[model samples]
Target: MGWLLMIALAALVLLALWKVAGFGRLGLQLAGAALLLAMAGYAWQGRPALAGRPVPPPARLELPESAFAQTREAMLGAVDQASFWLRMADSYHQRGDTYSAAAILRSGIRAHPRDPDLWVGLGNALVVHADGMMTPAAELAFNRAAAIAPEHPGPKFFYGLALAQGGRFDEAERVWLALLARAPADAEWRPMVVERVQMIEQLRAMQRARPTR
Candidate 1:
């Protein structure tokens, strides 16, 4: 679908150039067409990874299973509304297709750019795609989410998770500490964040104790 749209668009652009310019300065017109075609080719080459195979069969992804729903009430006000697409993305992540998961979230962002939850979802997927490493791209996603929804706890929590996964426990702890301080006492995700902070502390201690070979 995406490719076909791009091809159609390229043809339209070429046709418009032909009709408007009438091949006057034919070299420039041909160059424009060539550039459009090249772009289409590049998009097609990357389509497989960008729009990969179908995500895991649709299923209700639970909270504790992936920690995805931990901050559900805070993030999107609940799990069943616009967050349904987010759950689908999480399902892909659970099934080990982080690329597809990220792609789905990206599509969601394109339609709803201001939705911080989608940005956080993309960040989470990127973290998984990097094998628990928080790559720069993942960081950017988190930052975008945070910038868009400065008061939202989802971005901070997931950014911290990514840091912990990348073995940057101290950074993760700091992020989580700030989140905990601001998080409502009755918030459903507070306990989960506390649990993860404790886990990170323990992991940091162990890493410190392991003497270099």
Candidate 2:
């Protein structure tokens, strides 16, 4: 019976704790008392006679590639040494391992200190790792990237993205507006920026119309 198996398992655990784990007499007594309390609680509440059902496996978490990856490759060269590191980080990011992605970017930054693309990637990884919140460290990484390449669009675009994701929509709009002002008419990524700005405006309008309790 389930109750018999439960008691046997508890006894085995207590024996291991007392012998292999070197618990003293008082510790063993306390552990035994805790086990008895747990068993008593189970006896009162548990459905021991119910048929056992198979537990379903957990669903897999599928992470997609960054939306800005293509734009980044367009702005920053795809064949450079920095790109190798970025690709490595991207692999980790796609696997839902943002911490490892950020760490890999850090190592890349150490090797290529002035690589703006690597810094941008690091900022993104940090933001994702923080559950879409724009942490101070992520902001610093974006700023460093911008400073390294004053004319590059990657840092500003991704920085605005992080800000928008963190619910700082107003700040994101301002940053994107500035980028648009300086962006060339024929720039490939300019259309994407314009679209994002329009989306932000719509979001703000919806927020204003929302009824507050």
Candidate 3:
């Protein structure tokens, strides 16, 4: 019964190719031969009687949005033209659509070229889109944000984050150290930076202690 169904399906496919796909006589013959060979191989090795098993979906890598949003608000302030665009991009980022998030940030940057927050957001989106690698464009975006607001913590903090994510721990440490040196004692985001720096130090120590191949 299973063999009959397979043959019928193959025949229907060949007929469709001949009629709808405009296969010539020679092409139809070649396709038929290929189908026969496939059937023979299946008969020898395929297991048609096995029960189907459900496959769990692969895990998705995503940003921690709540912590991210809080940090952004703390560093860049809570309201502005850039804030609207950042929120819109965050919605897309939360949905695992990093491309759209980056695109939206690009649009926002075009409209407000000197908005440091938007540039930082674009850098972040681009890094996430590239699966945590800090691409040249993302680096450019972070640099632009820093150039626009020399004193802003958002650019340096998030740039260091992208560096750390890409395993450039030394560079991340330098960037965060500079930020910490200038950051005020009572700044809301200072604690996060301190924690991240400590984490990076621990990671560096672990790497040093790892057994070499």
Candidate 4:
């Protein structure tokens, strides 16, 4: 908005110059027209959204794509368990088939509705499926996980990443910072959580400095 105002002021100066100057009238008119066009562009860029919204960036996950299946299976166990199903879903997710990952989680939920971890996994898959947009279903999935297991870090961690992906960096940072406070001193995932929180803080600072578009 400030940039647009600055451009508008510059255009007014050109218009004023055109009125005062005997020669170079044509040049002044052309320059004023160009400045007006630039102001319009600046105003458009400052708008929060356009008629057709752009696709958001994809969400980031702590587990690298390669670690999805093998790591989870080795650490969490077999197919009948919800964690195993989460691993299977993650395997699909790693291949860019978020729909398949979501489907897997839905099936896992049918068998293990009480499992908060499965709910969190579904939320993560849904966020990815939506290209990092926080759809109502994804929000519900995360909320369900939090309700089922208030103390669990899985939902908050993944949901924070989703929030960050959607350009809600402040909210993401708040969620992560709170989660970090609750993390155990010797928790294996603590370092990763701390790292993510710090990253979000840096991202928030960058966002503040960035011009809106």
Candidate 5:
């Protein structure tokens, strides 16, 4: 579309310049056409990533049965009822209503303060919130969750993401790289770590470009 527009506009400019028979006017007209062509070229080059993604059949995510045990033990026997809050929390999450999800998570945490799962859920909500303060909340949540389930990878990943988002790049790299080492060989998150590594490299490039004192 942009290419067509650029061509039509260039043709119109050339035609007008031809009718006027002024070399000076033609040069200016050609310059304007050149600018339009450059813009068209840029937009044409950028259109693919903007296209919507094709639907994918849900891939079966295989974690250990220990995953359920970890999550359940974190609930301290209240796992069954926790679903009530989770159902509502998920609705809020789906709508991008993180505040409500965070509130529900907080309510669940308060009701079961020792429940590691609820604490982590609340922390996850805060991390994902549009207005969330990542530094303090993610720090607290991941710390608590990790303290409770030191062997689990989920909280550690969240912690790394939180650190990255908060500009703690070195720490985030350490956490994520360690996770990549221990993660299941074919786990989806290993690819995610690759993406995060790319992000960190971009940030490092920008940092190197800055005037450092």
Candidate 6:
């Protein structure tokens, strides 16, 4: 908004100079129109308002056309049926199609039990479906993947997420601390770990303040 205001002011000065150079009243009118448009655009952007209540940017959908496009491209030259199934599962996962994603990954796993990626995908799908139930199924799926590829971070992260979402904060804390220890000090997941730890502390404090049930 500030930049737009500067540009509009500059244009206004130029317009005034051109009008003074005998360009006629028509050039002045066009300059006035341009100034109004720039000012209107700046106002609509809502960054500098006298009222002090800035409007927020538009909310965007979680799943968008580009994610779908990527899925389409992934499917185009899939090496095998398993690859195609996995790509389709990824598309379903991106769209929050947990059941479909799990089913597809399960099929891929049944076809190729040795595929660590398939197991990891299945585990992630199960975690998504777990929501609040924290069912034994999700635990088993993650455990299976972790057992197959114990060094893989994907299963561990999902397991920690599942523990956190299930409200087992103590267990989640232990798991996340362990993950952070294994993960690099400057891992990209550091912020997420910090935030989750803060959330856990806040919730625990709230629980302590509540009356006994």
- Please give, for residues 1-213, the per-residue lDDT of candidate 4 as tens digits: 677668678966886776776438688778777777877887777665548778998864444563224333332234356867887887788767778889999999999998877887787788778877888998899899889888767677777877877877788889888988887898776776687788877877897999988
lDDT of 1 by residue, 138-206 (tens): 899999999998987778988987798788888999999999998889987788789999998787789
For model 4, the run of ten residues with the poorest summed lDDT: 67-76
TM-score against native, each model: 0.60, 0.67, 0.66, 0.58, 0.48, 0.50
Name the top TM-score candidate.
2
- Point to the candidate with the largest lDDT: 3
Cand. 2 TM to true fold: 0.67
Considering TM-score, which of the candidate structures 1 and 6 is the better prediction for this target?
1
Model 5 misplacement above 4 A: 1-87, 93-98, 110-115, 128-132, 135-137, 184-188, 206-213
Q: Is candidate 3 or candidate 6 better by TM-score?
A: 3
Clashing pairs in 4: none
Model 6 worst lDDT run, 10 consecutive residues: 67-76
The TM-score that candidate 4 achieves is 0.58
How many angstroms is residue 105 displaced in model 4 relative to the true structure, after the best TM-score fit?
0.6
RMSD score of candidate 6 (Å) = 18.0
Query: Candidate 2, 17: how far from true, in Å?
Result: 25
Candidate 3 local lDDT, residue 87: 95
* Candidate 1 residue pairs that clash: none
Give the range of the ten consecutive residues with the poorest summed lDDT in model 5.
61-70
Report the candidate with higher lDDT, 3 versus 6: 3
lDDT per residue as tens, model 3, 28-119: 99999999999999989999889999999875556668334657877677858998999999988887778998999999989999899899
Candidate 2 vs candidate 4: which has greater TM-score? 2
Error at 157, model 1, angstroms: 0.9
